[model samples]
Structure formats: C-alpha cells, structure tokens
Target: PVGGELASHQWRTEHFNNPWLLGAAVLVRDETAINYNWGYNAPAPGVAAENFSVRWTGSVYFGLNTEYTFYATSDDGVRVWIDGGLLIDRWQDQSATTVSAKRYLTEGTHPVIVEYYDRTGPAVIQFWWEPGAPPSPPSVQPFEIIVDDQDPGFQKAGPTSSWYFRSVGYKGHTYWTYNSDAQLYNSAKWFPQLPQAGNYQVYAFVPKQRADTKNARYRIYHSGQEHSYSIDQSIYFDKWVSLGTYYFAANSTEYVYLDDITGEPYASKKIGFDAVKFVSTAQPGPAVTPAPPPVTPVTPTPTCSIAPILGFGQVWNTNPTVRQRLGCPTQAEISTWSAEETFIGGYMFWRGDLRLIYAVYNNGTWQSFVDNWDEGQMESDPAIVPPAGRYQPKRGFGKVWREQAGVRDKLSWATAEERGLQASWQAYNGGLMLWTQTLGVFVLYNDGTWIQP
Candidate 1:
C-alpha cells in the first residue's frame, strides 16, 4: 500500500463559501443536513451570506446486511456515495424535490461520502434511509414521515415572543404567535427532534384571513445563517406550503422563528403562526458526529510580578462579566491598542498560550479570550460600571457593535449614533468624535475620573 499506512475512515467535514463547492471552503464547526430556509438573509452565524456548499464523510454500519433505500430531498444539487458505490445523484438547482435509490451492501462498517451545493435563494437538503421495500416504479412517490405541529416534536422555544397553539387555523389546529408588535425582535419557534439527522423538507400549514396582514414573516434558524422569509397570510390556506429547505442540527440551537411583523401596512393587521412540517429527505452515510482533533491543553504559566501589570494599584472590583471572561491577569503592562480611544492607561495581560486578556484603567474593565475571541464582541457589552452609574454604549451608544472578521471592518461601534455631524474627527460635548465613513458618527469617552451620562 502507498505510504504503508491506510487512510482511516475518520470523518471529515468542510463548509464552502461558494455554492458550487469550488473556490475555497471553510472548515465548519460541524457537518449537518442542509435543510434550511434562510430567506433573504445569511445562513448561520459564521457562515457565508449565500452560495455555499458542504461535504462530509464517515463510516456506516448496515444492520442485517440487507439492501437499504436512501433518499435525497434537496434543492439546488446533491450527490451521495456509500462504500465506494454511488447511491443518489440529483445535481441541479431547482425547487425542493426528492429522489431515492436502493443499494445492496455488506453488513458492518462502510465509508460514506456526501456533497451538496446551494446556488441561490432558499436552500434545503436532507438524506434519509430505511430497509428497502423494492420498486414503486415511476410516477409514484415513496413513503416518508412528517413531524407536525400537534406532535411532541413541536415545542415552545424562544425568549422573545409569546405564542399559543390554537384549534381555529390550519390543519385541525395551528400554533399562533401574538403580541408581535416588535417585528424582528418578537419571535416564536417550532422545534421537532427528528428520528435522525439528515436533510429534510420543511412546510408550513398556515391560513390567512382578510383581517390578517400579507407580510407575515418567519426565520429558519439552522446550522448556517438564520434564514428570514416573508409570507402573505392572505392566501394558501391549509395547503402544505413549502418554507424552502434547511439543514437542522439536532440538540443544536436551531429552530424556526415566526416574527411579529404582521404587515404593518395592512393597518395593524395580525399575523398567523400555525403548524409546520418536516419530512425526511437525505440520509447521512454515518450515524456518528464527526470528531475533531483533541483540544490542546492550556499551558502552565511562568511566575511573574503583578504590580507593574496592575498599574501600581488596581483591584478586580468592577465588570464581573469581563473579569469572568478574561480571568485574572498574571502579568499585565500598559498598552496602546487603539490610538483613537484615549485612556489613562490600557493594560495587556498575558494569560499565556495565545490567550488574549485586556484591561482599561477606567471603571476597571477587563475580559479574557472567551468574551473577546470566542464571542468576538469588539467592546464588552454593557460595559457595566456600577460604581459610577455609567454603562457602555451609554445613551447615544446603547446599541451593541456587530461582529466582523476584523474590528475595523465593522460598520460602526455599537454605541455610536448618527447626528448629522460634518467633521471627520471632532470633539463634541467634551467627548472625542470621528465621522467614520464605514458606518456612522462615533464618540469616545476617556477620563481618568468617573462621570454619569
């Protein structure tokens, strides 16, 4: 054998930025069924905005060594192979559809491979399988299981909106979200744990009445970016309407969100949230989640003095959130991280092993790599300064800055607001001002002393 070492059937997963599986792809946190309907929005946190692909590999164990039927319910394109043999091959961009095949196999472990691409718009995919029952011939579809609203799979899972399962709407009964005046922020969710993980087609059974608005919206939260969709509830009553397709992660924070924007143009009309469905689509080659390389242990630190890093006299008596995130600094020194934001002193603490620890003298703000690197928030959220009655993003800066690959690429700091200022950099009301061309006006505050906003 080449190299005298067999390439183990270890699972490998990769995510693509381009829909065609070409160009370059990122290694995702995990591989999953592509059953998502991120209508008019990014797929998931850290995923591409649109046009992406996914590939996964693993070994499967066929029980009884019998022939198994496999399905691929997908939009765009998909290809599957098991034990070096092709099973399902439907490669084209189209509406959500299903295709299947039967294959004989030896029992025990066999390698499986899957590849998929989403060219545009709402995207979904699923892989499903079961013991074969043989030729249903053409024109007739095979059997599939559906997870409905009234079923145990449907769950109440949201922190933003209120909802109720009503008997007066779509198919026998429908769950509806009320008090949705907040639009994007208000949301209701439908979560059903599938029998297994793979691609699945999702549909909604919602009815619209004259009193309802036409622009009811829902967001499909799946493995990638959360999908946003607008539906006019005035038509398609009780029909099994497609809500695109998506890859749903089991036990992951994935769920469909029905927002409260019931078309304000329709004169404060109410929105409808009803039964949703998930039908089996594609089946994975292996039943196991791909494992990543073991995490390297955090290295032990060398002993160091703390007086210089702590600025002569500084206590960990402020911003618990930041303190909890960054941990106690072992050896900190005055830093000049940002040239614009002036401070009495900025401290860069070393926790070793490439850990990032930052602290500012003002209000004793500090955070470790968790809040800074993992969460990737540029500024500590709510920079709470209870001792001084001042908070981060105070007043004109109450908003949190969005995350970007780089701090400079972000549109604006979360706290800055547009006030129609003209100068590129100016001092306003005793605060530093910069009219950033990237987003909006920004004002920075730096004082050795504390003051309330």
Candidate 2:
C-alpha cells in the first residue's frame, strides 16, 4: 500500500514526465464495470482527477478455456495485473493511449487488478476482453438468399423425403393434419447459396398437424456458426416458424440440417419439413450524410388510419359492453397485420396500460389473438413499440415482424400500413417489451402473442 504515496509525485505522473520511479499511495477507491468517460473533471466532483489515484480489483469470468488479452485505454498512468503477475507496467504520465497484455487462463474465474492515476486534462478509461486473439482481418463475406418451393436451391433427403413442402389440400387429402406433408431423414441436410453477404431470417413452413412429430430437430448454419432448433410439429401450423435470423458469408456450401439425434427422450417419430425460406435482414452498410437543402423542408401532418378490419373494427369502435371493460383506444386506431389466407384485417387499440389487438372470425365477431394474466410496462418504455405484422413477399415467403422492416414490392395483407411503421419499433429481435405506467413490463412476440415476462 506504500505505492499509494508515489501516486501524488510528478515522477510517477501518468505521462511519466520524470525518469525517477516515485512510490504510490492508494488513498480512496470505487468499483466500476470498466466503462467510464469523464472529460475535463475529477472522477468525483470534489476530488481533482489531477493527481487522483484509483485501483480497481475484480474477477473476470471466462466461459471457454482460452487465451485472453486484457485491454485498457486511459488518458493517464495505468497498471494491470492478472493473478499475481504484472501484464502491463506503464505507470507514467501519458496522453490518451491504449495498452494491452495477453494472459493464458482456463475456462473459469481469474483475479484481475487495474491501477490508474489521472494527472490532468480530460479523463477517460475503458476495459474490455474477448475470446480468442484480438480482432483481425475480416473473414468470410455474409450473404442474403431466398429459396422458394420451386427454386432449384431447395433440396431434400432420406428415402421417405416427400415431393416438397405441401399441405393436404394441394391433393385434397383432408386426412393429413396440415393438408400437406414433407418428409425428413436423420441428419438430413439442405444447402442453399446466397448472392452476397448479409443477415437473413430463416422461416420454416409450420402447418398444424396433430399427428406430426413433437420434437423435430433442425439446425441452421451461417457464417461459420450454427444454432439448433426443435419444434412440436403439432402446435404451430399454417404459419412460418422462425428458425432465427443469422449472418452468413457469401458461399454456396452453407446448409441447414435436420438431425434425429437429439439429447431429449422421445420416440422414433416421423418429422415434417415444409420448406426453409430465407429473407435478407439487417446488414452493416456504409453510412453517408448529405448536405441539407437550401430551403427549410415543410413537415406533413401524420395521418392515423387502420386498414379495413371487417367486423372487428365495427365492434372495437362501437361495442358497448367491451368498451366498459377494456376501454377504447386512447389515440387513433393503428392498422395491424391481416392474414393473407383468411383476408382478415387486424386492429390495435391502446387505452392507457390496457393494450389490445383484435382479429375477426367467420361469424363477424372479434377476439383477442392471445389471452393471459396481466403485467404492465414501465413509464420509461418507448411510447410505441412496433407491433407484429405479417407480410408475404412475392419473391420469398414474405416478412413477419414478431412484434416489430423495409418496404417491399408485395406484402401479405395482414400488416399492411402506411410507410414508417418500422421506424417506431425499438426491439432488436422482433419481440417488443413496453414499460407500462402500472405493470412492470409487458412483452409482445413477433407471432402476435402477448405475455407478462
């Protein structure tokens, strides 16, 4: 602890302006998550960052046993140690600069300590670590692709592989649960190529089939990474089941696999494979800012409107008993996704913390898509989170926001609305979490399901 005294000496200043090594004395300290940006001020208001000294000690958890490099970027003198050994020892006055040291450790916890001193001027400190070596050259190019029913990119396996992803009605065999059926094999694999690099969402045709397999396993591989997914082929039917979105480097060899060897205990059941559809998702692209026009642009009044919601709209706006219970829309109604196959327009209404989405039935009645106990959102939640909308693009299966895209050529009627719906969504993964004034948090899934998570 005697080193704490040297912290105040100019010889031990962050810049190391003096060649002499002065002793340091640790005076006061605080804990942090290693992310801080304080400019032209002390770490604490009264304490001067100049000649201020701090020491941070903690344990870093590593999931995998691998070599890691601890990096520290600071504007003053700093020292880092792992275990009982020193990795970096530049305890001298310095301007904004970064220094790092590598350490070999097992897949577990390791002790770490960071000592820093701010001599003067702006103060900045940051620390971070990642698996494997530091970031290097870019690897493969990500890809965007679409494999349709008729597209040659589609492939099947196993002796029992059906002709394609089809429902029973295609052949009028109502006996089949989903009207159509596709077959699968153990370790069955399909390879589809992409035209370029980017992130893409993989959706599988899931038609309800009571007799279908309960634990059909599927895996999607992209950009040197793969994720496993399992489905109860009986529950979700007549819908595009998402296998999750992933990034893929441009390559014709990338594949999606359906394997029978799942770790779970199940029978030797027959799995179905409608078709795997891929649609381009968000990918990093260059950004450019353009000069503003000489004249000020006029703003247009935003129009609020909902697509024709059939019977549901009439009751949502007129029903007496329902209005007394759930209340009516606080603001104007918003258009929501309508099913292309059913030709039903959906409506979203918000009355304070009471939020509801409505769809119609054959008997001209309206009902909520999902039902459950309640939770509310926090006051800090975004005013509007993108609602689930279904759109089927002509080129691919189409896009469906979980509770959350770009405008495309054609869309299934379900989520049709005026431009700019995507701009309001704050969810990164299609699931929106809203903070309500009363309830803590309410979640809306991309498939139009609600839960109080």
Which candidate achieves the best TM-score against the true structure?
2
Tell me the lDDT of candidate 1: 0.44
lDDT of 2 by residue, 368-407 (tens): 2211113452322244343345333221112121221211
Candidate 2 global lDDT:
0.42
Compose the digit string of candidate 1's lDDT tens values, residues 1-453: 112112333445667888777655576544433345555466666667668787766555555334566777777788875532345668788878888765543344544667777887777766656754432322323223444556665555455235555566555566555434444434556776655555455666675432155555566666543544445566666665555555556555766666665535423566566677665543322211111112221222222222212211221223232122223222333222221221112221222221222222222111111112333333344444422322233211121112322121111121222222222332111122223223333222221111111
In angstroms, how far off is 291's CA in candidate 2?
27
Q: Mark the regions of model 2 whose C-alpha exceeds 4 Å error after superposition.
A: 1-76, 79-152, 159-187, 210-216, 223-235, 249-251, 266-270, 282-453
Task: Name the TM-score of candidate 1.
Answer: 0.30
What local lDDT does model 1 show for residue 412? 17
Computed on alpha carbons, the lDDT of every model, listed in order, comes to 0.44, 0.42
